[model samples]
Target chain A: MKNKTILLASRPNGVPTQENFAFEVQDVPALQEGHVLLKSLYVSVDPYMRGRMSDAASYVAPYTVGEPITGGIVAEVIDSRNPQFPKGTVVMDRLPWQQYIVHDGSGLSKISPDIAPLSYHLGILGMPGLTAYFGLLHIGDPKPGETVVVSGAAGAVGTVVGQIAKLKGCRVVGVAGSDDKIAYLKEALGFDEAINYKTVGDLKEAMAQACPDGVDVYFDNVGGEISDAVYLKLNKFARIAICGQIAYYNATSAPTGMRVEPILLKKSALMKGFIVSDFAQNFNTAAKDLVTWLKEGKLQYQETISEGFENIPQAFLGLFSGENTGKQLVKVADREG
Target chain B: MKNKTILLASRPNGVPTQENFAFEVQDVPALQEGHVLLKSLYVSVDPYMRGRMSDAASYVAPYTVGEPITGGIVAEVIDSRNPQFPKGTVVMDRLPWQQYIVHDGSGLSKISPDIAPLSYHLGILGMPGLTAYFGLLHIGDPKPGETVVVSGAAGAVGTVVGQIAKLKGCRVVGVAGSDDKIAYLKEALGFDEAINYKTVGDLKEAMAQACPDGVDVYFDNVGGEISDAVYLKLNKFARIAICGQIAYYNATSAPTGMRVEPILLKKSALMKGFIVSDFAQNFNTAAKDLVTWLKEGKLQYQETISEGFENIPQAFLGLFSGENTGKQLVKVADREG
Candidate 1:
């Protein structure tokens, strides 16, 4: 069988381009014992993947040049030598951006299509969901009646974060790039307030107006000027969970902004950074809560799905430009029995 | 009897000078039934006091212009109408910078002259000590074989912080402004390594050389370029205790520097700012450990005593220039029976 794979052509200088990724066709190898032959159904393209494209030391290893770029993918098991993952079983795992993958069934997590859609495992029911769950609940620790300000509030993790904060009885305020996202966060997600950062006259003033009680919990996904403004209005003992810095992900040079120590000192605040995997030990507990919330219709999610395997690079690049509303994904192939 | 008191004449524009303080003389009022006549002996001059000199919102209420500047002062009860405190009893409390004070004795903490020196109540056994204890043990939580770096390492809090981290079996590196302070930290305080931040050609390079294992815990007493350099050397899961930011205390305008969120995110680190009072519920536990360490000779302290009540303003100004080695105290008056 013929398989197509996307490889990291070169490390990006600033914002990544089409030249940074290359596509190659190869013959799919036969599945070996204890291995599974997987056909990609849905591939996730997230802001965090930008960190992997660089050679910098990070939580996850950087993507090697001329190698298949790997990420969270929902795939159908077409052929399996392992009984644990039999044929026709849909699973999710960190897999390469390939049409077909030959993999040992080590890290593959079985996904139940009955609970939600197959692609939902790549988004709200998967990494983005887990990231928001742990980062917001565990780190942000929003208390009832307190105000929560989440940047990039229309994106995957940010959407879930704002929703969870609202569920926790917090006054949820969101900061996003577009009016559409701002409206979606406020109208659909039930956020107390939403500010279009791009359109706001003065972000700091807008944030103050949004959070009248001052920001008690800040779920930071976009770190830069938005975060700087948030720091100014932090209430005493505020909790800040630094989940992602999408604003600085594409910067070629070191990004500089307002020093936060003095502000944090004045507010006696806490700022912590983490990836979702840091809370892996408690994933089952979080997953249970997340599943229950989704089932009860208390949680909502959106995805910007780009069609075809060839559009994966463009889909990923579009993340930096705020092209997608929620979880950005690439639909590579259809599931087959 | 006559009483002399220092008042905040005007708010400091940047670095405070003698012009900001005014001395006033008045008649000492007769003590009330619940009051004690406190004679100020040793008055503490802390960098944190600079915050109150401004009208800005802070953990402590800003000192009102034309009102007495109050701080940690070890006083002798010359006359007392309260049964709780008798004549000649030494007490420590946040009191006005006055030669004589008619206080209600509500917040007075009785001090023992035998435990250490009377001045020690303003340094090793007082606020700075407690600040170091809670901010280090509770926030930093340095483990054995870990690398702990403390900025302002020769200051009262930093000296104690470095010693405590050493007691916890961690490799301790100190950052100070002067060669004398650096030598004092290494030779007198038993710091593993010391960096003179002012003299160092490249602080980042020096920190890299000093903390080869990377910084696991950072007890930051001075925030500025020194802190920026320390942030670069933070190891994964590093914890930073933001105790003080003396570097920007005298700045006329808002200070800005390198953003720390991305660095913290990349390393999965934690940075928290706090005043010692934030952990007041656990102060007794910290005091017990601190007292035990001091008696065991495991902890040592130094204080620069500026004589005369008239020089208190100059003594406070000296702190910004890093003139004091450990604790900075002004000897107001001799204790009287």
Candidate 2:
């Protein structure tokens, strides 16, 4: 059988386009003694992946050209030479953007269909969930009666952050790009107040109205002007968790905004930047808590899935445009027994 | 007897001048039942005092126009009606810029002459000493073998910070203004490395060479371009203690510079701004530890005393110009028995 894979054709200067990716077809190699042959079911497209596309040194290494774009993928095992793997088993791994993959079980976790869904393992039960969990609890540390303001509030991570802040008995305010997202956050996710940042005339004023007591904990997913405005409203001893900077991710050159240290000094605030993987040691506890919250209906999750393996690039590109409201993913194939 | 006082003649637009203060001579008043007549000896002038001169709301209330500028003052009680304050008692209080004044002992701490010099109460054994103690130990938390970089290294708090970091067994680097200050930091204070930020062409490159292992803890006393340079060299999970921002204290408008969140996010670093008073609850232990360190010769202290009451404004103005190498204090009069 033949396998079709998408490779990074070229690194884009600014925003990525269809031309940045190329597809290749090759015969699927037979599994080695410790290898398992798998067919892709779902692939996660995350904002952090934007950092990998660039050559600049970051927390993670840059993705090389002519290599398959790899990320969190859920696949069903069809053939195996290892005793640990059997046919019909589902697994999650850092797999390439391809119709089929061969895995050695390294960095692979078996997915149980009884948990939630296969797609969830790519999002709420996975990276996005852990991002919200640790970033809020560990960094933000929202106290009861304290106010929390989260940017990118309608996105997968932001939505979970707002819900978790509410569960901690904090007054939660959300900022998003669209009116639909604002409504979804307030009505569906039970956000105390949500604002459409694009429509707001003055974000600082809008934030002031939402967080009357001033923000004590800010879980920031979208940085730039939104964060600058948030800095102005920070209360004494406020904690800010920097999860993502999606606003400047696609910019061709470095963006300059407000100098942060002066304001941080004035307000005696704390700001920290981090990635989800930094808390890998605590993932097991976080996943269990997430599962319990999911069962208790205290945590809600959403996804924007595009069908077909060919649409992987499109789904990833859509993140910059704010086209997807939730966890953006691509469905490669149907689940099989 | 006549008492000489300096009142705020006018609020400064940016950098304070002699015109901002006016001298007044008034008759010393008799002590009331609960009050003691204070004869000023030594008064402290700090960078944080500049914030009080402005009308903007901050950690401390704005100093009122035409009122005597009040701060940490060490004085001797000449006449006392309050039984608790006997004559010849050396005390510390938030007193005014005056030669002789009356105080109620509400915020007063009786200073024992047996402990240290009378001027020491306004510096190393006083507020500035407590500031370096809590800010570095609590916020920076420099672990042994980690690299600790302190800005404004020749200044009062900065001097102690570098010494304490060394006491903690960390590699200490200092950024000062003058060559003399740099010499003092390396030769006298035993700083591992000292950089004259004013003379350096590219501070980032200088910092790179000085801290080859990268900066793990940054005790930031002077903010602005100097701080921007420090941010570039932060290692992953670095902790920054924002004790002061003297560089931007005199700015007429907000200064904009490089955005910090992206770098912070990439490095997973933590930056916190704080005033020494935030750790008021732990002051007793800190002060005791500081005294112990001083007695054990592990901690060193320095003072820059300006003679006469008239030089108070000059001493304060000197802070912006980097004129004083250590804790800046104005001596009004000698202790009266």
Which model scores highest in lDDT?
1
Q: Is the docking of candidate 1 incorrect, acceptable, medium or high quality?
A: high
* Residue-by-residue lDDT tens digits, candidate 2, B5-34: 888888899999999999999998867898
Candidate 1 CA-lDDT value = 0.92
Chain B TM-score in each of the candidates? 0.98, 0.98
Docking level of model 2: high
Q: Write the per-residue lDDT of candidate 1 for residues B96-157, one digit (tens) a residue.
A: 99999998888789988878889987888889999999888888999999999999899989
Task: List the RMSD of every prediction in angstroms.
Answer: 1.1, 1.2
Top-scoring candidate (DockQ): 1
User: Tens-digit lDDT track for model 1 on A1-337?
Assistant: 8999999999999889999999999999877789999999999999999999999888889999999999999999999999999999998999999999998988889998899888988888899999999999988998999999999899999999999998999999999999899889989899999999999989999988988889999999999889988998999999999999998998887788788999889999999999988998998998899899999999998999999999999999999899999899999999898
DockQ score, prediction 1: 0.86
**Alpha carbon deviation, residue B231, candidate 1 (Å):** 1.0
| Deviation (Å) of B216 in candidate 2 | 0.4
> Candidate 1 at A160: error in angstroms?
0.6
Predictions' DockQ, in order: 0.86, 0.82
Worst 10 residues of 1 chain A by lDDT: A250-259
